[model samples]
Target: MELKSFKFDLDERQVKWIFSPLRDKIQVIELLMKIIKIILVDDKLDSERIKGKVVLRVSKMSRLFFFSEDKFFSINFPFLVFHANKDLSFQSKNGNKVDNKVTSDVLGLLASEVLLSSDHVLEFADPVADIEDYNSGFWSLLKELLLFEDGYIRYDYDDKHVNGQRHPLNHLDIFYCSGSTFKIGLRQRITDNHLMDLLDLETDSHFLERL
Candidate 1:
C-alpha cells in the first residue's frame, strides 16, 4: 500500500468549538494532515490516517421533543477528515500540545470502522445513484462510525527517544466498536478531544425535546 502524507493548518473561525472555555485564551494554530493509504485489497479498501487539530463544529440542530421549539442543541459534529489533497484548514486559540500524532490514532479507528461497514462497490452503475444514495450513504456511515461510541475512546501517552533525544508520543490502542465490540491494537495516534468535545456539547443540551 502507498501511504501519502500531507499537512495543513485549520481555519481560525472553527477553533472556538474545539477548545474548552477554561483553556488559555491565546491564539492556537494547529497543522492538520491526512495520510491516505490506498490499496487494491479484496474489496478496494483505503486506509486513511488523519492528523490535525481536534476542533469540532456542530453543523446541525434538532428539537428537544417531537413538537418542541427548535433549539440550537442536539447537534452532531462528525470528525472532519480533511483530504490530504484538499484545501481545507483549521487554527487553534491556544497552541499547547498541538500534535497531530494523537489525533491520527483516533481517526484511524474511525476510518477502519467506516471502511468495514461501507459498500465498496455498487451493483448498478447509474450516475444518479452515485449522486444521491452512494454519496449520502458513505457520509451517513462515516458519521455513525465517528460518533459510534459517543466519543468515549481512550488514549495512552508515552515518551520515546529518537537520535538520543526523548520525545512525547500519544497512542490510541483501545476502542469500542459499534458501541459494543471492544478491540485493542497498536496503530497511528489520533486525539480523543474531538470525540470528547462532541459528547460534552451534546449532553449539555436537551436533545430529546427536539427529537
Candidate 2:
C-alpha cells in the first residue's frame, strides 16, 4: 500500500496526537476491538469460529486481547499487537496502571509471511513478550499493515522509562529500515478517535465514507 493511496493528509501535530496514549487499558482495548471490527467488516472477512478456528479471544487471566489460532484475518495480518507499560496487577476497569516502574506484557498484533510464489518460506510462532524482546533463533513473520515500500506500522506507549530528554513519554515511530528511525513526539495522549482516523487515512477513507 502506497502512501499516495491514502485519503487523508497527516500533519505533524495530528500524527503526534494519533500515536500518543490518552486512554486507559480498558478504553484502549475497546478502541482496538472497534477498529478491528471495522476492518474485518469492511473487507468482508470472517471472524467467527469455523472448524475449530478461533479468530479473536480475550484472556481474563492475562488481562489481554488476542487470537488463539491462526488464519484469523483474510489478509496476511495474523495477529494484532498492542502494548502498555502498566502493571498487570494494577490494571483494572476502574483505573489505569499509572506506575512507571511496573513491567507489563505487550498486547500485540503481528503479521505473517505473505508468500509471493509457491516457494516454501519459514514459519514463525507468535508469543507474548515485552517490548524489545526479539528472539534471534527464528525468522520473524511479524509484519503489520501497509506494504508501503515494505514498511509496517507500530504504536508505542512509553511512560515506564523516560530518561531525561532521550526518550519521550509518548512517541510514534514510522520507519522502513533497520538501524533507522523517524520518531514524532506526541504533545497529547492518543484517543480512540485518533486511531480510527489514522486507519481511515491508510484505508482510503473507508470509515469516513461509511459515515
Candidate 3:
C-alpha cells in the first residue's frame, strides 16, 4: 500500500507527537541533529539548547562542560573539553591520555543521565591548557562526535583512526546524520576580565529582583 507523506511544518512538537510510536529509536537521533543544525547557524535560538541548559539550572546543579575546535573538527562534552590546533588539524586531542567523550551517541552525550544527577559542578580553569587528561590522547567513544562543517558532513563509521594517527577522521556519516553544520568556534568560552564587562553577560540587579 502506498502511504501518504505527512507534512511537517518544521515544528518539533509536531514531529514528536506525530511519530511518537517510533520515537525511541529515532527521536534521539533527530533531536541531536536538530541541536547540531541550530548550533551551526545560531545555537542560542535552538530550544533544545536552551532546554538542555534549563535542565541544568533547574537541577540546581553545576555540571562541567567544555568544547574544542580545529580546522577539520569541533567537539565538546559534559565538562571534559579538549581541542586540537588548526595547524595540527590531523591530530586528535590528547589521543594518548584519555578519550573525553561521555557517551557513545551524540544525543546521549549532550543530554545524558549525568545531567539528571544534581551533584555536578563546573570544574577546572582553562583546563585544555594545563590539564593532563586534556593533553592525553583522545579516548572514550561515549562523548565522541566528529566535527562536520559545510554541507558535506558525513561519517563512515568505518574510518575511525587510532589515536595520534595521522589520517582524516571522518567516521561520522553526516549525510545520514540528518543535518548540516556551520562554522563552529570557541567564542562561548572567552573570559577576559577586560572583555567580560563589555559583554554585559548578566542582567542588572533590578532585572534579577523581578525574576
Best candidate, TM-score-wise? 2
| Cα RMSD (angstroms) for every candidate in the order listed | 21.4, 19.3, 22.3
Best candidate, lDDT: 2
Give the better candidate number (1 or 2) by lDDT.
Answer: 2
Better of 1 and 2 by TM-score: 2
TM-scores for every candidate against the unseen true structure: 0.19, 0.27, 0.19
Tell me the TM-score of model 2.
0.27
Pairs in steric clash, model 2: 20-190, 79-109, 79-110, 80-108, 80-109, 81-108, 81-109, 82-107, 82-108
Cα error of candidate 2 at position 142, Å: 15
Q: Give one digit per residue, the lDDT tens place, for model 3 in 1-211.
A: 2211111122444333322222132343333344333322322334442211211100111111111111111111122222234111111233432211322233433454453343644321222223325433222322233331212221121233423223333232222232332221121233222121222224232121221
Relative to the unseen true structure, what is the C-alpha lDDT of residue 31 in candidate 2, on a scale of 0 to 100?
33
Better of 2 and 3 by lDDT: 2
Model 2 global lDDT (CA atoms, 0 to 1): 0.30
